[model samples]
Target: MNLNLPFSDNLPTNKLSASFANTSATYKFYWLIAIIEIVEKGQVNIKKREIFSRMISNSWYTVNYFHVSFGKQDLIQNAVEDILKFESLTKDIKKENLLSILENSKKIETKKLLEHFNLNVPHWFLSPWFPKLKDENNSNYKKRIYSYSQNFENCCLYGLYDENIIVNPIWIPYLKSNSKILKDFCYWNLSLFLQSRNPNVPDIPNKLIKPAIRNGLTKQTNEYWKNVFKELGYVECIFTGTKLLFEEKNFAIDHFIPHAFVSHDLIWNLIPIERSKNFSKSDNLPIFEKHFEKFYDLQKVAFEINKHHNSKSRYMDEYLSIFPNIDSFEKEKFSNTIQPLITIASNNGFLYMNE
Candidate 1:
């Protein structure tokens, strides 16, 4: 997973390679990503707050929606959590909109959270280039790093300032030319760091950024439930209690445990609910204690029908992973499997309806 930066005679390739060496927090990785993004936009004079704001927005979904723990030491997750109290934004809010909101927010609390990084990340990220600054115990170590970066004859990544960092004219070409590779390097290292903290969490890399487009469930899954409705004559929405008819197509398939938490579309987790109710329930966990009996009954009926009539159904295999004996699916066994996932999703900050 090492990132081999393109060879450059003028730039310090060795320092770039060591940018994330022995990192305790995720600031450096995100700081570099923000820099690359601004550079790609053809901007050289970048605001420190802009970089910090991008850091929070970039990690927003990973922390909020996907519930990836960035460890107790990581404050980026904390900032994302704190902002929720002040704004009514969705976990899956678009990146550009999120960034604009962060950049334009007038709330002092928001500004304080972002500016806190200016104390260390701006200069500390350059420690790889100025290795001597590492051991300095002076109260003004950050000032010293800034001084060295500005006075260095060759090239430092950028010149630090009170409000912004000016990208070195020499490095601009290198940054823009290899922007994609440099970003890949940051994300590759970031994924490894997150994976260590979240050893049990699946799909670490994919969870890092908000998806451009979430893949919709395959038509086969939809048709499987449609067949269930056909055999039973009707299916009731678990959340709204509205009865749905198959011929009307007035139902939408929903994730029993919000797909944001599970990050999958397994058949066992999919259910058909009233189309209107599904819109309001977007990405929220259903109240399991209240909703489980009805959900389990519906799923059990689907399983039995599909197993007996359509023995070769593609989705029937999905239950075998959760219910080992598909022939004998018990409510208690299904409860044991789903209850903890709902609990974990709640603990990770996914909300329940009417919370």
Candidate 2:
């Protein structure tokens, strides 16, 4: 997962590599991403607060929705959680809307949160280029970095000011010309960093951004459940207890644990619920104590019926991965499998419906 930053005789390419070395928190990665994004937009004179806003916005979904751990040392995650609580925002807020809100926020607490990054992130991000400043104890240590940045011979990434950072004129062309490569490098490193912290989490790379579009469940999955309904004559929605009619297609298939949490549509996690209930249940965990038994019973009946009619059906294969033997599948085994996911999803801030 090397960065492979474009070689430049004029710029200190080695320092760019060193910038990402021995990182403790996720701030540097997100900070660099914010810089690259701003640079791409044809703006070199950027506000430090704007970079901070982009850092929070970029990691919003990773922390809030996917629940990716940015590790305990990371304050960015704390800032994100605080803003969400302070602003009373939904986890799924759009990036543009979230950024706009962050930029325009007047709350004193919100301003303080973004300002905290200025203490270390802006000065420390350029530490690799100015290693001498690492041990300096001067009250005006930031001023020294600012002085160095103004000298093009030093080739620092950006010139820091009291309120903003101006991209070094010498390095602007390099950043803009190689924007895509530089972005991929940052994300590649970020994915590796997150994977180490969240070893059990799946699809770490895809979780980095709020997906622009999520693919719908396959037709085969829908057809498989339709067969289950047809054989049973009717099925009750676990969430609302409404009887669903297959003849009228009066049901929608959904995840017992939210698809946003599981990030998959495997048949084992899928169940038919009242079509109308689906909208209300979007991305929320169903209270396990209230819904698990009914969900288990419905799944068992569906499995038994499906196994009898089409034992080799591809839809049944998903259950085999967890259940191992379809004939031996028991409620206890199913509970062992599903209960932790429910708990973890809840811990990750997926609210329970009606809670």
Best-fitting candidate, scored by lDDT: 2
Residues 1-355, candidate 2: write the lDDT tens digits: 3567789877788998889999888999899889999999999999999999999999999998888888777989999999999999998999999999999899999999999999889888887888778677755667787778767436788888889999888888998899899888888888998888877666788888888987776574456876777787899988787889877877788898888778887888988888889988888888888899999988888888778889888877888767877776688879988998888777766788973
Candidate 2: count of backbone clashes, pairs at least 3 residues apart or interchain: 0
TM-score of each model, in listed order: 0.88, 0.89
Model 1, 1-355: lDDT tens per residue? Answer: 4766777997887787777789888888889899999999999989888999999998998988898888787878888888867777887788899999899899999999998888778887787887766787755778888887776533788988899899888899999999999888889989999888876566788888888888886584456886788788999888788889878988888898988878878889888999998888888888998999999998898888878877767778888878776678888889998998888778767889873
CA-only RMSD, every prediction: 2.7, 2.6
| Whole-model Cα lDDT of every candidate shown, in order | 0.84, 0.85
RMSD to native, candidate 1 = 2.7
lDDT of 2 at 94: 96
Error of 2 at 34 (Å): 1.1
Query: Lowest-scoring 10 consecutive residues by lDDT in candidate 2?
Result: 217-226
